[model samples]
Target: MSNLSDIIEGFIKELLEANSQRAIEIQRNILAQQFDCSPSQINYVLTTRFGNDKGYMVESRRGGGGYIRILKVSTSIEEELKNFLNESIGDSVTLNKALDLISALRERKIITDREQRIMQSILGDRALKGVVYEDRNKIRADVLKEMILASAENDM
Candidate 1:
């Protein structure tokens, strides 16, 4: 049998799939009670499995009527890529963020699996080992930005 976290994740994903908007809001206490676990456990599954890298955004309100809002990223590939380039990334991007961007691109079929592996390899920590800690993110961001722009130009 799957663990509680997996079960919870599956349940939430099912909800998202069932909704046309691909978004859902659930009260933490209500969900916890339904799952027979603590609210913190639900939070753990959310943070680890539904992060931007995994292609989901989670927003939570804390209070007596707190609700967790989960949104699956937009499916329009071109618009999504533009948003990422203009807003999600800036002068510097962490390795995880870069990986997330790459993963999203792969998920959307914007980039092939081979391209995904190549981009990941090029932008990974090992590839940046020679750079100073302070400069790694900046270099990664620059490389990613250029790669995306180049890909866009080629597609045109």
Candidate 2:
């Protein structure tokens, strides 16, 4: 059986797909109860799976009648690449965040299969072992930014 987080994520995605509007509203506590998991698990799946880079936005209202609204937003490849450029810090990226960007690029089909593998390999923490977190983050940022630019050049 799939883990609760994956199950919950799939269920929510199914709901979004079935809806004509491509959005869904659900009560977090109710979802947790339905899945027999803690509310934090729902939060984990939403943050890691339905993230902004994955083309989903999450909104929440707290208190008695609180609800979580998930909206699917569309973005062009160019715009997404530009967003990555804008968000990069000096030259380093934490390993997890670099992997997130690589996954996003792959999800958008902005990078080829080979490119994805190359990026994943080079961005691995093991590849940058012994480098401090701050330095790794900046270097990852620089390399990813360059890769994005190279992709753009190929498009022209």
* Candidate 2 ranges beyond 4 A from true positions: 88-91, 125-134, 152-156
Q: Local error of candidate 2 at 64, Å?
A: 3.0
Clash count in backbone of candidate 1:
0
RMSD of 1: 3.3
Q: Assess every candidate by TM-score.
A: 0.72, 0.81
Which pairs of residues have clashing backbones in candidate 2?
A: 91-138, 91-139, 92-137, 92-138, 92-139, 93-136, 93-137, 93-138
RMSD of each: 3.3, 2.7
Which segments of model 1 are wrong by more than 4 Å?
1-7, 47-66, 73-75, 152-156
lDDT of each: 0.86, 0.81
Best by TM-score: 2
Q: 56-150, model 1: which lDDT tens digit per residue?
A: 89999999988999999875556666777877678999999888888767766677898889889999889889999899999999999888776
lDDT of 1: 0.86
* Ten residues in sequence with the least summed lDDT for candidate 2: 83-92
